[model samples]
Target: MTIRMQPDYRLSIAQIVPRTEAEGPGVRFALWFQGCPLRCPGCCNPEMLPFEGGTPMALGEIVRQMGQGLESHGIEGITLLGGEPLAHAPGAAALARAAREIGLSVMVFTGYTLEEARQMPDTAVAELLAHTDILVDGPYVREQPDSTRRWIGSTNQRVHFLSERYRADDPCWRQPNTLEIRLREGELAVNGFPARSAVGLWRRPPWRTPRDP
Candidate 1:
């Protein structure tokens, strides 16, 4: 599939973690783009929803970083997360193309359903989907929060295996939620879908007993 580059070759990114085991099938370099039109209720990364925020980065630079991540961290793939990755189709497509050229599997998480995304008028969106190995799609519904599924937020979200790189029958994909925490530069970032119990624990103070003040 031919992938088209954005006219400016720039992507507005919320964040990029060089390595993370919680984003996909294996350890991966995760890229979270900035800007999202669909403000899905109970979105986990609301900070990334603003279109005007995030650093505008060159596609080349982002690809260069992914390459470095592969070499330095021995990552298995790249996971594209966002503020609706499909909203920035061109740049996201370009990034996916670059990652695949180097033999890295591409996994994308989006608020758009697979059928809805396929109907998009933009060819870039199709191209991006073509290169994607696994796509987790659907809006995050607060009423359907999922804890048993790996790498997905809500029960309504579906995981599409576009390529044979991963199998649906694999137990790893259906395992209970697991969270990966990273401490960098004194900032702690948590990745992955946390179980309800985990969320409660995270909210509770370590020093306090269940009934203590």
Candidate 2:
């Protein structure tokens, strides 16, 4: 019998944003991949919308860069953000597998809901999920803001445990609650607000012109 192998797809990385304190877990190197169909309104990095803009990077080069990042900064782990990680499942899975081989846990942020990932046509998404330790899944809702929350952007997104570590009946791993926050900056900043004091509606002058003040 002969064994056939699948060719690895090169990933298009929109941008590599590093040493971010906000993303998740700890100081981490984040990879923002190109191409997202969801196009959620008010997405912070709208520049990542186009699929053709990023550089095409091979799996080996990506892993090497991550290893270098880990060694240079002693960071905790790598977080995969995107135009949508599930968009390039094969490449992302390859990257995540490599990261795991190097002893780094993977955290993936996706616009797809947990149910959506389970229904993805591409088997690669499931493969990537298998390798992923923590998955923050769902599209961002402007009304359901993070409010200076720790890891998620909205109240609807759920964190799923893909590893065997999840017990058969663990509620915490199954349905974690959305976080509520009050910024130390002052008044409570609800989800999606700037990481500072909440703004008072009275502060804005109704008479102010749009272009001239």
Candidate 3:
């Protein structure tokens, strides 16, 4: 019998939406990494910016969950959102590779431009970029809120279709942005772009507050 080895890499994640249509193309598994070095003003995920808090999960476990999502929800892809995915590039690369191995597409949202990402000193960042099919890059400028592009936060950010899996003129990208709300594991969680007037209307109960891993 062949001996099997478990994946040992772990990632610190602020949130995990197993299946979401608003995160990227089609229903996708969206992961928000816990820490970010860049302090972009008016960041959407302010809670996720600190390096201390998150759920530390093994690569194997995350892969298992991805498989479950694929089987249950038929997710077409995986999207890596942040607290800066490049800050956790090694784990992100590993996850991207795993997703690709299982025939899933990969999308990434990053504060760094394509040029900056290419110049990063870490090879893992490069690896993650290689696995990415679409990358939405540049910092979120609150002043330049993009009302036209679905899923993009600001007008300064650029969308790069690194691979041929998607197209700029795709009708999917032209659709209006939407918010997804779900009662997950007894906690009410919301994802996607929210209307400005409704931004602070709801808050998670105390049990769902951000905590250290």
Best by lDDT: 3
TM-score of each: 0.87, 0.71, 0.88
Candidate 3: give its CA RMSD in angstroms: 5.2
lDDT string, candidate 3, 155-194, tens digits: 9999999988899999889888878776645666677886
Model 1: per-residue Cα lDDT over 69-154, one tens digit each = 78888888999988889999988899888889999999999999999999999999999998899999989888887767776778
Q: By the TM-score metric, which is better: model 1 or model 3?
A: 3
Instruction: Estimate every model's Cα lDDT from 0 to 1.
Output: 0.78, 0.64, 0.81
**Lowest-lDDT window of 10 residues in candidate 2?**
200-209
Better of 2 and 3 by TM-score: 3
Which stretches of candidate 2 lie above 4 Å from their native place? 1-9, 164-213
Model 2 per-residue lDDT tens digits across residues 98-167: 7777877788999999898989878888888888887889887767876434456677777776665333
Distance from true position, residue 127, model 3, in Å?
0.4
Which parts of model 1 have CA positions greater than 4 angstroms off? 6-8, 174-176, 195-213
**Per-prediction count of colliding residue pairs?**
0, 5, 0
